[model samples]
Target: MRPLIGLDQVSVAFPGTLALDRVSLQVFPGDVLAVIGANGSGKTTLLTTLTGLRAPTGGTVVDADGPVRLRGPADALTRGVALVPQEPQLATSLPVWENLLIGHGGLRGAAPGRAARARARALVAEALPHVDPGTPAGQLRKADRAIVALLRAQSSRPKVLALDEPTAVLGDRGVEIVAEATSRLRAEGGAVVLVSHRLRDIVRLATRVAVLVDGRLVHDAPIGEVSVEELVETMAAGRPASAQVTARVTGERPSGGSAVPRAREHRLSVEVLAVRGLREHGLSVDELTVRAGEIVGLAGLAGSGRSRLCRLVAGASGGSAPVTFLGGPLPSDTRASRRAGIAYLPEDRANESVFAGLTVARNLEIADVVPAGLGTLFGPRPDRSRTARTISEFGIKTASHQTEITALSGGNQQRAVLARVLAHQPRLLVADEPTQGVDRTGRAAIHTMIRRFAESGGAVLVVSSEFEELQELADSLHVIRDGRVVARRPPDCEYRELVALATGARDEKEAEQ
Candidate 1:
């Protein structure tokens, strides 16, 4: 087949980073290309460039027949391209029908009347047979959100579909759904480019795999030629040394009765929060606790009140408050929660965390603006040296502390956010979807940071819709569904059990209703 899309000597340069450097690649009809890379490896930047959301500083992008003036996402869409961003945003007030139509080209201009309605029904049936067409898209789970997005994009019958982290928010079943969808798309002769950290998706859907390293394309080959471990190592090597070594030396503890004795002392104690009749869109909690040195994982489908609970605890949400920290109930305000040493890392990093135009040093210091030496804001104005050290320690890759945050890659931006919160050393850390946009190396670094926090007698309340993430990170797991915690289990909760709880499979109709 002739190439559907091609990049020749493409390069993208920001103030302090070269996001893509002299890169060349091709996409063909019926191809599923998995783009793999470390955090700062430019996967997103490359996608943006392909979709015409960005202009290359050098080289050219040829689409279908010839070189074209890449204008915007709309232009790319009209030319047979669509991108499902890392954090797919949807209009909360819109119904599933409207949301899907939004992708088709807004509600007003979309195909109208009974024929349009028939087409919408047909499109939904083809893409998501299980989703309720009349239901609100906001009411859908994160996995469903991804599925709906895919459906919306595919509804246009684009020649190429760009899905970024499509399964990042999904469960095992959701992953299977995406895999099946990819297979169907390929069968229909449409090319799919999937960017993801999950190895399973790549293995299942990709015919070819390409790995990027620090703005350069390092590995481009057939999927059958590489193993997951080899891919991981290449991506890891591409990362800065700090990110690679952050999780260094696990299982190196002294073996003896002292190690045995330490296990008993590792128990975490969670303070009781006001757990009375709390209700928000069907999610309710009777009681919850967060113990120091323990990782509490909240697992559920999207809109399961997992994120809402985090917001309530962080004092960011407008809800009835009985949430507590350190034996005292958390105040019904955000500042009070922060004052009590609870740091929340939001799922939407770009929107919720980091002040974009500021310097990296200043951004890192925002979490806790404490004076190092003189203990005065006016005197020496917060230690730049300490901020730089924190940046290095957290394995963030930046040109310098003075570099603009917007210039760094998504993974690096995430790393900088981690450095910011971890520097504060909060007694209780509430991280909501911490690894959403991060690569393997960055994920490992974040995992290490969370573990170290727990080891150092701090509490961690992690709310993740990704079942796999909860399974790997939580010392204990709780399943939230319909806005309430429906179940709890030990850290090593069986994946089946976690899924069962998340989907409310075992719960009676009364409980779910």
Candidate 2:
């Protein structure tokens, strides 16, 4: 059978890096192609080239009909090829049914007439029978949002669906949702190209596996022909030399402050902030705290009030004085949070956390300068010595300190942001979806950073959609449902347990409520 889509000796280069080097790949009808690689191995570049999100620096892309000329996502989508990003920004305020007919994931300008609504309902029934068609995209659980995205794409019945790390932040149930959708697509003669680091996903859904090593197609074989062990070995062979760790963070707590919260009384000797009664914007937190040398995690589905609580704690203006930070009311603004020794990593890293236009060095140093109201271009040259040290300490892989942050992979960008946050030497770290889009290698590296920071007596509170991540990272894991702390378990809590509590899926009776 002819391939539905393919890359013919494609190459993508960014200044100092060859992101894709003469890589050739093909997706046949009914194919579930699994693409795996280590961090910065050009997995993303390959996907972008295939989907026309990025024009190849060299070579061409050919479809069954002929060589595709246009290099744009719209052209690809128009030709029945769509790439669903890792974090698909759906229209959260609109109901899932409407979003399926209008917006990024769906056919823009598709009238929401009776027939359109009928088609959307049929797709939802086929892919996500449990989800309500009318539920706002924001209110559905994380997994549901992901599934709805698939259904939205399926509405167009694309010839090939390219998914970028769809299951990275998901659990067993979430993965299964995508898996079932893939099966349904393949059964209908549609092809899927899955870019992921999870071996289980490759083993579970892929009809064929393709491994990239430093932008080259190093391995490609039928799923039945390879073993998991060999796949792991192949990817690891191409990993760059392990990143070096140069220095440890100073764990010393700054001298105590006398200002206390008048909102509520606190009994526990606080290490991080202690929230007694946090009620704002439909979220309510009765109690949550992290000791100086501990890591606490919050796990919940989408719209469960996880990010809202983190924002309030991170010193965004609003909400009651629900927290006491090192004997003072919680800092009320971003600059104050940094000044008070608190570093908050926002959930929307691409838009909120990192400055894509800035270089890696500038991104690292801006946390310090911005608080002082200095522009990156006009600011006194960043402390070159400290910038170098932070790069080494954070394992940020950039061609040079002067490299724009967007040039690097998602993992490297995330580590750079973490390094910038650490530049403030914060007492508490509030990280949301810290490892959201990174590969297994990057995930391990980030986990090490969080652990070391907590080991240094810096308190931490993490919010993650991935339950397994929270289980692995938190010393004490809290489950939030409909904005209340439903349960708290030790770090060893199982993924299913957290999923049940957060999703209200414990038992038939509980699921009803």
**Candidate 1's TM-score:** 0.58
Model 1 / residue 434 / CA error / Å: 12
> How much lDDT does each candidate structure score?
0.71, 0.75
Off by over 4 Å in 1: 103-110, 125-132, 238-324, 327-336, 343-513
Location of the lowest summed lDDT over 10 successive residues in candidate 1: 255-264
User: Positional deviation of 497 in candidate 1, in angstroms?
Assistant: 26
lDDT of 2 by residue, 1-513 (tens): 888899999899985568889988889988999987654578888888888889998989999986887569878888888887777668999887877787433455545678878888777766667778777889987667777777777777788999887874454565787777788788888899998765665788899999887788899889889977677667656322211110111222212311211111222355677888777656677788887877788977655678878888888754257778886788768787788788899999899988988888888877767566644566656689989988998898889999999999899999999988977678999998998788767877888888878766788999886555565556678877666677777655444455456544442244331
Model 1 C-alpha lDDT per residue in residues 1-513, reported as the tens digit of each score: 677776888999986568899999888987889997644578888888988889999999887687876888888888888887767677757777667667464445755567766777777666668877777778887767777777777767778888887776665565676677778778888888888755656887799999887789888898999987577666655223221112222332222201111222455554523354565434577666777777788876554568878888777874355555566666566666666577778888888897988988888876655324335555345677898788878888899888999888777888888778777678878899888766666676777777777788888888764555565567667777656687777654445455445544456343342
Candidate 2, lDDT over the whole model: 0.75
The residue ranges of model 2 lying beyond 4 angstroms of the native Cα positions read: 103-113, 125-131, 239-336, 344-513
